[model samples]
Target: MSATPQPVVRRGLLDEVTDRILAHIRDQGLRPGDRLPSNRALSERFLVATPTLREALRRLEATGAVEMRHGSGVYVRADLSRLIMINPNRLRLDGAALLDLLEARELIEPHLAEAAARNASDAQLDELAANLDRAGRALDEDAALHTANMNFHRTLGRLAGNRALAQVLDSLIDLHDQEQRHILTLYADRDHDHHVHLAILAAVRGRMPVKARRLMTEHLRDVRDVVIRALEA
Candidate 1:
C-alpha cells in the first residue's frame, strides 16, 4: 500500500496530477498490490475537484498503473497493458501477430500523421525536429536512440490533437515497444529508423497533410519489412 501522498500545492491539469501520482509511487517505493488511500482522502490531498482526480486515475487505469477495486480499494498494478489496450510478456509475439500489428499501424498512422500536420503547434514540431537530431547522434546504441525514436512517434500522437485517437495509438505503440525490448537490447537499426522519422517529420512540418500521410504509410511499410527480415534471419 502507498504512504500518504503530499498535499497538492495548488490546482493543476490532469496530466500534472498523473505525473505527481507516478512520482509519489516512485518516491514511496509502492509495489504492485499496494493499496492507495481512499478516493475521498486523495481528492482532499490533491486539492482538486473529485472529478479531476477521478479523470487522472482513469488515465492511470488505462496505462495499467493502478486498479480500482469496487468495495475493496485501489491498488498498484504491474502495468501489464503496456501488452495492452494485454501484457506483452504473456502473449505470443509470433511473426503473424507482429504482421497484424503492423497492418493496424499502416491503417491508423497515416491518418494520425495527416491530423498532426493539420494541427501541430510550431513548438511541437520543433521538439520532434530536435528529437530527430538526437536520434542521429544516438544511432543503434540501444536505449538512447530507441527512446528518441519512440519519443518522436509519441510526439506525433500528441500533435494529432484528438485525445481518443492519441490514447489508442499510445497503447498500441506501448505494446510494440514491449516486444522490441529484446531486439533493441541486442541490436537496433537506429539509422534506418532515424532517417524515416526525419522524412515523416519534414512532411508534417511543411503542413502538407497528404504528404505526411504518404510518408507515414511508407515509413510503416519499411518498418514492417525490417521486422520481417529480422525475424526470418
Candidate 2:
C-alpha cells in the first residue's frame, strides 16, 4: 500500500513579512550600506502592527540582512546577497560542537588563504593590510580587536574567488561567533594572534600561495589548541 502524504506546513506571517521586506529591498535596488525606511514607515507600508513589524525586522537582523542601529535607523548589510546562511534560531554550541566548528575552519580556511594569495588583486591586498593595521590599533581593546580579526578572515575568504566556499565559511563564522569570542577571552594572547595575522597577511600580499597556506594552517592550529585547553580547564 502507498503511504499517506505528509501534511504541508503553512508559512507564518513573520516569514511572509520577511520575504516582502527582502522583495522591497530588491525592488528598490538598495545595495549594502543603503538606509531603509523607518520602522513606522515600514509598518505602514506593510500594513502590519508595530510589534509584528518589529519582530519581522528582528528576524532579518538575525540573518545579517539589515542592521538596526538605535538613533541611526536600519541599513543594509552585505550578507543580504548571500545564497546560503546559518539558521538564526540555532542552539548555542556545546564544547564538542565548538571544537568541530574549529576543525571545519582549519580544513577550509587554509585553502582559501592559498587561493587568495593566487588570485587577490592589489586593492584586495591593500584591504588586508588595512585590516591588520586596525587589528594592531585594537590590540588593547578586546571588542574592537575581535571585530577586526573576524573581518580579516571574512575578507580573505571572499578574496579567494570561490563564492560557494566563501558563503559556507561565512556561515561557519557566524555560527560560532559567540563561542569564538568567548574562546578569545580565555586564550588571552592578543599580541600573538595579531602577529600571526600579520604573517598571514604578508604571505598573501607577497602572492606566496604555499607560504600563505602554511601560515593559515599554523594560525588555526594555534587557535584550536587554545580552544582545547579552554575546554579542558
Best by lDDT: 2
Clashing pairs in 2: none
Off by over 4 Å in 1: 1-90, 184-188
Q: What is the C-alpha RMSD of each candidate to the true structure, in Å?
A: 10.9, 6.9
Error of 1 at 53 (Å): 18
Question: What lDDT is reached at residue 104 by model 2?
Answer: 96
Whole-model lDDT per candidate:
0.78, 0.90
How well does candidate 1 score on lDDT at residue 91?
A: 76
Tens-digit lDDT string for candidate 1 (1-233): 87898655444588888887787778788889998877788878778777778788887887789998889988899763233354534576687877787788788889999999999999999988998888788775677877878788877977999766766777667767866655655544666667778889988999999999998998888777777777877
How many pairs of residues collide in model 2? 0
The number of the candidate with the highest TM-score is: 2
Model 2 TM-score, 2 decimals: 0.79
